[model samples]
Structure formats: C-alpha cells, structure tokens
Target chain A: MAYIKLDREKCKGCMLCISVCPKGQLKEDKGLNKKGIRPVRFLDKDCSGCAFCAIICPDCCIEVYK
Target chain B: MKKIFGRTRSLRGVDTHYCQGCGHGVVHRLIAEVIDELNIREITIGVTPVGCAVVAYDYWDFDCVESAHGRGLAVATAIKRLQPDKIVFTYQGDGDLAAIGTAETIHAANRGENLTVVFINNTVYGMTGGQMAPTTLIGQKTATSPLGRNEKTEGYPLRISELLAQLQGVYSVERSSTDSVQGILKTKNAIKAAFKNQMENKGFSLVEVLSACPTYWVLSPVESLDWIKNTMSKVFPPGRIK
Candidate 1:
C-alpha cells in the first residue's frame, strides 16, 4: 500500500495528476481550497508508489510514501 | 513508511506564482531537485529571466540574480567567468531566450561558457499576454497572430536546441517536454545532464523544455498536455540535438 499526502493549499487543482496515476488513486474532492479550486484526494486501495503524480504535478503538492 | 516523493529541500515550501497547469512550476521543481541531488545549492548561482519566470529567484532557495529582458545569458556568462568554481545556470522563457536574447544566447554558447541554460519554450509570450514569439509555430494562433502565425510574415519557429547544437562551443543540447510523466522524467534527466556537463567544465549546455501555457493557450490542463504531445512535438520533436 502507498500513502499519498496532498498539500491542498498549495494545489491549484490542475487535475494533471489524475491522468497520470496508474492506480486511479486520485480524484477531485468536493470541497474547495482557499483559491476556490477543487483539490484532489487519494481514493484507491491499490497504489504502487509510482511517483508519477509527483513528477507530472506542476504544483509539487503531492507527496507519496511507501 | 518511507517518503518516496516529496518537495526538494532546495525549493521553498510556498506556492508558486505560476498559473494552474503552467509548466514553470514543474521545471522549477526539477531544477531544485537536481540542485539538491548534486549538493550544489550552496554554490549554485541562478540567473532569472524577464518573462513568466522573472521572479524565479523567489521559489528556489539559492543565490539568484534577476537579469533584464533577454539578458540572462550575458549575466550568467559574467558570473560563471568571475567564479569559475561556482555552478551557474540561467532560467529563461521562449520570449526571453529565443527572441530578444537570441544574440546573447548564441554568442555565449559559441564562446563555450561553462554554464547551464534551462530554456522554457512555451511558443508564446506568456507574461505579455500571449503574443506570438520567435518560437511560436507557423500555424499557431496567439494574441498578436489571431489568424495563426503566418509563415510569410512570422518566418519559422526558432529551433534553439538544434541551432545551438551546431555551434562548436556548445557541448550538449537537448529538447524535452513537461507534457507527460515520461516527458517530465526525460526533461529532468536532460536538466541533470546539462548541470553535470557544466560541473565537468564541458563548455555550454542547454536543455530546451517544451512547456505549456494553459492560460494563454485557452485549453484545459489535460488538453494542453495532449496538444503538446500530439501537436507541439510534431514541430519540435523531443530528443538530443548534440
């Protein structure tokens, strides 16, 4: 299992991470950040710690742990 | 649990000024990661350009100097020459490097300055409201060229990496993109290699990154990446030029 922490305040809700995550581990959260953007949340159970989300994220808001 | 991916210590924890889906933030993170990995943050001197990344010094926790419009290469050259041991790099955008700073960049590379240049080619003058840039593709539409860039008047997109590769003083040149996971990884490696070449005192090294300007392109974040892979890469393919 992999753990991903998102710095919601730092996120701009670009959604680029969603397209890159192989595990479908990230999705848009209903709540909005201070910037009025819907930040992403970790959602899947079968994460493989691929850091693709971190690499593709323009905001550097996601941190993955294994 | 061990941390697998986290923000590099070289980068400030604050949010960047870049717009959503802008590639500047990713490029900045990659450069910060490279600087941290090489343990050269203390000795590295970055020259920030006058385009969208004009305030790049605020994000990277290192010594940075702001250069005038299109003068980043000239400033970086002076810094590298004065302190030969210090690591010097320039962060420039398409409008800054491929347009106004063309002469400075070419001459510096031709002189073989032991420096690294991270050029962001987003195909438009992003900070100046999406004006057509020298790197703008012939058929791409911009604020200045609403009917698409006309070949007769705009000439052609400036292939800076290929152009710099032909110069004898340049030791390494690569064109990469930040549009996908694989492209981002390749871009990171290219930037690292550019820095390594400078560390080895191997003349001039440049990594031209095809970045996205979603705000100007008027595309969603995902569409911009798709355009980069499907459209942009056709005009400027990703690969090593030198």
Candidate 2:
C-alpha cells in the first residue's frame, strides 16, 4: 500500500504534483475536481512514495502515509 | 518609487546616509521588493543588525527589531517561535553574520527553526569603517588587513552558504551576487524561495547576497563590481548551494 492519496474534490489539477514527483507516480486522470482542475491518479505498482510531490504542492492536498 | 509591491511603504523617502558606491542600498531595495511581491509586509518581522544595515529598519516599513552586535539569530529565533504564523527574518552583513553572530546563526539553522535569513556578504566590514570581515577574500586590503590579508595567520574566509546548507533545518540555501543584472535576478529568486519555504512551515532558509564595499574597498562603483567578479567570486562562486 503506497502512502499517497489526493482528495479529488480539493485537487486543483495544476499538475504541480505530477511535475514535482521525483518518481513519475502521479498523472492526470479523466476526471476534474470541483474547481475544474485535473485530479491526480496513481497506478498501483509505479509509486515509490518519495513524497517530493506532496511537499512541493502549494495546496496541502497530498497525503503520504510513510 | 515603486511600492515594492506595497512592502516598501515603510520607507519614508529620506536619502540614505550610506556612501556613494556602497552595496547596502541595493540589498535593502531587493528585500523590500521581495516582501512586497509576497504580500507579507504586515506579517513580516525583520531583525536589523548593528552593521551598515543597522538603519535598514528605518527604510523598511514593517515591524523591525534591533539585535545586538551578534545576537540577531537569538532574537529572530524567539520571535519566530512565539509568532509561528508571522514571517520572521533577519537581515545581517558579514561582520554581523559571519563574525560576531556565528554561533547564534549556526545553532538556529542547526535546530531548523522556521525563519528566513538575508545575509549580506560584503568582503569588508562596512559599518566600522572597512575593517576585515569573516568573508574578506585573501590578498584583499582592508583597514585592518592593509597589507592584503595573509592566509597564514588570518585564516581562509568562511564560505557561509556551504556551511549553513549542511544543517538539517535548512530547507533552502543559495548564494548570489549583485555584481550583474543576471545575478540580481538570481538573488531575487533565492530570496523568494527562502520566504516561500518559511510560509509553508518548511524550516529555515538562508540567502547570501554577495555585496560590495566601494568606498572602503578603495574602488569606484564600477571598480567595486570588477573587484567582486575578479577576486571575491573566485573564492565563493555564486549559485544554489542547497
């Protein structure tokens, strides 16, 4: 279980998370958040859980369990 | 006359008392501009040291605190802890940061308290009349080291950015100079990053702005820039350290 999660409702879809992710674990999904920003999606096996993306996010929307 | 994004309102437009070619003026304007762009002027608490930048609080319109010869870090540390929500920073010159206040700065960054430090690295001490500073380049002449600083006894100048970046609490660290326009932009970005990190509660951030002292260095304003490029930058190359 990767310690990564993003609240789709709150995600602004700025792609900053995807951009900042050291290990390309996140991508924009088919859906949009309430603010019309693309929400991030995670493929199960690709997550290394670096958390660089989470920390660089201007909005505190990312959660990493580890 | 621009508002520094509204952060410079604290300045009263009085002609500064600094010498003609001193770099302190440029350093002050840069800080004010950054504070304005971030819109953190009201919430920013800046500590001015006793060096040439001692009058910084006067030109900057914010809650300016005065620290003793080497106690800037201690005072800033206390303020940041109490007002966690406020943006606390310290503006200090080489004489204040590298010389007298070395321990205070080291320990504060070592502990990684949430604060910003805008360090001015003019090779010579500007306030006390061009005395030798901790960052004085080797073979450089100053009031004390008139014979050109001999590394044999005076010791090598301390590269502050590299040293501070070694600490765990330091989230951002960069060294830039005002000797050129490109360098100025780099310094502005570094300063922004320091404040941004502090805003997000990341930890301590230090930006060392390589400055010049023309009058005391016995060079014209243009010559001072040349001195910084040819001499100072060789020892402490400007770039992001951490």
- Please provide, for model 1 over B95-165, each residue's C-alpha lDDT reduced to its tens digit, 9 standing for 90 to 100: 99988999999999999999999999999999989999988888888999999999898899988889889
Per-residue lDDT of B117 in model 1: 95
TM-score of chain A of each: 0.92, 0.79
What DockQ score does model 2 reach against the true complex?
0.01
Clash pairs, model 2 backbone: A13-A38, B10-B61
> Candidate 2: which stretches are off by over 4 Å?
A1-66, B1-10
Task: Give each prediction's DockQ, rounded to 2 decimals.
Answer: 0.92, 0.01
Residue pairs of candidate 1 with colliding backbone atoms:
none
- Per-residue CA lDDT of candidate 2, range B1-242, in tens? 11111114444444566664466665776677688889998899999999887888877888999999878989999998898889999999888888899999999999998989999998888888889887888888899998988899999999988999998878888899877645666787899889999999999899998887777888765577777778889898988888
Residue A23 of model 2 has an lDDT of 70
Please provide TM-scores, in order, for all candidate models, with all chains considered together. Answer: 0.98, 0.75
Candidate 1, residue B45: how far the Cα is off, in Å: 0.2
Indicate which candidate wins on DockQ. 1
How large is the C-alpha RMSD of every model relative to the true structure? 0.9, 16.1
Docking class of 2: incorrect
